[model samples]
Target: MKGRTKLTGLVIFRGDPGYEAARKNWDPHTDRFPKVFVFAQRTQDVSNAIKWARENKVPIRPRSGRHSLEVNLSQVNGGLVIDTTKLNQIKLNKKAGTVVVGTGNRVGRIANTLAKQGFIAPFGDSPTVGIGGITPGGGIGPLQRSIGLISDNLLALEMVDAKGKVIRANSKCNSDLLWATRGGGGGNFGVYTKYKFKVHPAPAKATVYRITWPWAQFEEVLKAWQRWAPFVNNKLGSELSIGPKKGGNVSMEGLFLGSKTEALRLLKPVTSVGTPTSSIIRLLPYTEAVKFLLPPDPILTQRESNQFSSGFGRKPFTNKAIKAMRQFLENVEGQFAGFFFLNWGGAVSRKSPRSTAFYWRDAQFYVEWNSSWLKPSAAPRNIAIVRQTRRKLQPYIVGSYINVPDQGIKNSGPVYYGANFPRLRRVKAKYDPKNIFNNPQSIPPANHKR
Candidate 1:
């Protein structure tokens, strides 16, 4: 460690004033009391933190936006958490039609930033999700079908390797590393600092729509949506949510990259089925549409306990499958329980499966469900509800999304990366041979089989 980079950022030891707040993640259930937290202000700070952690023989975790959903993914007991929230810097190249952004930026910030420039970038539903985490796992949202996953737009990235050396990856250099980072999942190879993304010019105005139905109409509405959503015009992207009978209702919300007339016409299939309790459609500026589609930016300090599971639907759900879903929803006791579906064709499926580490390109739709609770006592039942639902729907689902990690899934490497797992392992070997960066489900170097 003779040439080790000294820790140069805001380093907070366990007993520091902000240690309690710095150690918390988006979900309270996954938070842990780390030995130290380093809020990285620059790339060198990240490198120094990695070297400092190694010098002290402490586990290391890279965190941004603190939105990691699973335990130990972003924070660990007695570990070093390298926080990147302060590295948020946005540089737009209008001439090249691209943007180079710090990985620490959140989804909502990027959306709002790009919108102000009259450009748009793909983003997920949650405004608080960090780009550093989501982009690697194939970021999905309303713009997926229209603009492709955030990873698909990725052009280059800068990362600090296991040895605390800064490196750049793109199509020209360290190409394999670039390929893996596209969809191979974060915390596998290195800690990303900056990302160069191919951005799209935004249309002046777009249509945003929301349709709701009584909870009893879940079956009919779901059937209609599944049949129509994936095959609809690529310009339109939609999501359907089926909530628990206790405190939920069926609803569909989407953004159409066109006028209200065309959007309503394309939505006829689902809109014609169940007698919707209410329907609202409006044409608004692209920036406003983003605000309308996404939930409000979450308070960074706010925390909750929750269990989440994810999967891909290769084909439409059969009656048995639909019945199973309904049964699970009916039996779930929590008010914060529901299933979310996103149509998954269009630009997402245009690329070959092997093009990037993301391999679920052929899926027709994506589905995920969550069971959340405020009390620690409710953990068991809530976790069981999600696990049981996954078991019942296992036959109809294919792979799981790495971003939405589910600890219950055995042999998750294949479930998340499919055939690309081997290549990802090789990349891991090349970039992090000793596996300096690792988590519960992180890929092992190729020579060391799991």
Candidate 2:
């Protein structure tokens, strides 16, 4: 028994066969195989691992959903990886309209569970994305316009500090940590074992609209979408997608949160912009909406190229910006890919900028100039496309999304947290001064000079 239960969790060394599974992440681009993966089964196990890593001075990487864009949080060459996937448990409170979720749960599973009870949680575009990671990174998804980002709905969080002590944060206790947890990227302060969400009743049915436009008419559709996209109805969650599709054509995809009849009426202005190659709009059960927005978890060797930048749109896309977008869309080789634009109003903007650590309160749209490189050699070319596209649209953009960062910027503290970076640094130093929660993106202890 001396050797057993050294930690309250299952600890596997470098040669363990299970290490292969624990080392991998969702993104197929980079392969990160950590030397040791401590599968934390409980909060006590998490605390034990923290003390071990601290004494050994091992660089620690925290993970739950491993749905990370950058390889930092998922891989640490020879260091220890504290895996929270095993802490899979959920405690629901229907009366409070909240649920404390295990970090291990993915958006799809959580959404399905909650939807059964007529409740919905804010999730990312991918259903497989973990709630642990997205909740802290200012999660925005199909329901953002209705319930707002996942952060907005966050009521409290339970985290294990760098010193192996567990604490809960919210408006009442550890208010600063609460602020940092809202919009600041996760895995910084400590290992978040659970998240309490303020969920809401979902619509009985949602309407999704898909309209494809030819490559030849990209400019006209692009110009018109820029004008009408930001000012749409608050209840109507909308987005305009311009990207490569099958047969070398561009696609314009959109989603609305109301009846198909009302959606058709709301989309009249959009249809008038240009003739869609194929337009389809309909109302379906709230659960079916998941298929249209985020298809079921399909196992594929998928590679994503996201220049994770963000921008706010206070006014309509100007002629200059629209013309610039047209030029960039026309410049692409038009392969099988996509450029996405998500609406930022409705419930998303209801909270003020300073309400939580996340900024971009008044901004109306989040432009994710993302691409998918199916092949290895295509990575460089795809990156260049991202740069060129953003360069053309930079004037009209403001900030970037941490979920899909460019990887070029070193000071991600500013890029990811924006105005909230400084406070985040202080929080990191206060709770994790020893830097037990160390990773490339984890908040660096701010006490170095203080």
Model number with the top lDDT: 1
| Candidate 1: tens digits of C-alpha lDDT, residues 189-234 | 9899999999999999999999999999999899889999999999
* RMSD (Å) of each candidate, 1 decimal: 1.5, 3.1
Candidate 1 residue pairs that clash: none
For residue 376, what is the lDDT in candidate 2?
A: 66
Q: Model 2, range 297-396, lDDT digits (tens) per residue? A: 7652355533333455656667787666555555444343556677777787778877788877777677765555556677777667666666677677
What candidate 1 gets wrong by more than 4 Å, as runs, is: 1-5, 301-303
What TM-score does each of the candidates earn?
0.98, 0.89
Off by over 4 Å in 2: 1-5, 245-255, 300-310, 313-336, 374-381, 388-392, 447-450
